[model samples]
Target: MFLFIRSLLKSPLAVGALVPSSPQLSRLIASQVCCGNSHVLEVGAGTGSITEALLNLGLPANRLFVIERDPSLVAHLYKRFPNIQVRCGDAEHAAAILCEEGISEVQTLISSLPISNLNGDNRIAILEGMMNALAVDGQLIQFTYTANCPFPAKRLGLHAERVGRVWMNIPPAVVWKFTRASYAL
Candidate 1:
């Protein structure tokens, strides 16, 4: 109710529509998945704003795994989208999910967690887990209000590029696209 509306207003990019409008289902669907055959791993699927977008973007519901830490949010996800495998846990435990799913690699990873809100160690751990779960050609899309790349985008031995910006967003935010740097043969 109030929380859902607050979330919608907080992240304008996550939910494309302004108030009293249908959810911005398109923006959420826009992600880093390549070739349309990607296993998407989304972190901080708050209120399923991005989750709904992911589904609308044609990312197969079965192949998409959402990790939400808040129990209330997880309940919301389950109620809204019963088909999705919404797990109630921390994103830092991402590796466990990978192992449980027998997912050797992910094609794309999208994170909306307030990386700025995490402690240094927890932030590092979560990013490292995502790196561990990604394939060689996998891509990661993350958004932040900061002017710089969040966390160790490159410090983790991963190459990062600021692909685009969404000024229409409430606080205005930038989108970073990360990938493994190419090694010459």
Candidate 2:
């Protein structure tokens, strides 16, 4: 908790919150993932909060991969979730990270990163990498505290729907489940 707070204080834009995501929000995000063939990839997995929720929801640890940019948080995640893999890298470079980790595609990509705070290029790159890594029927689960789409789907020719909302969080949050352009709502 102290580590997360310190990171958040040091870099508000990067950390995006005064505290880690609420477990309820984490569980809500995890519940959106359905059983599938391809593996699951989680981005910005700070302190493994969302990872733990996914694991508790019966996701196979071996089939789950997490990427956290901060080396310190990555180290904490590694120590916390020893059975799971945690790669220290940027979400914009997800494709390369996955390829380096022997993952061609994923059935789901759940993200804890704050897209609203990232710059246009970084946001586009992250979304592009996610789209490239997901399967045909895959989903991208992203949560934001804002009322509307933080990463507007219309800009990317994609579609997003509110799958769940957690008012119990520090400032409340909404989980928007995004799908491919052709399959969007």
Top-scoring candidate (lDDT): 2
**lDDT at 105, model 1:** 67
Tens-place lDDT digits, model 1, residues 25-108: 227336545635657888777777677877777777888888877666678888988887888877777767867877666778
lDDT of each residue in 1-185, candidate 2, tens digit only = 97797778777899887678888998999988874767899999887789999999999889899999888898999899999888999887887889988888888899888888888888888788778888777889999888888776887777788887799898799899888878755
Error of 2 at 111 (Å): 0.7
Give the poorly placed runs of model 2, Cα more than 4 Å off: none
Query: How many backbone clashes are present in model 1?
Result: 1
Which ten contiguous residues of candidate 2 have the minimum total lDDT? 150-159
TM-scores for candidates 1 onward, in order: 0.80, 0.94
Which pairs clash in model 2?
A: none
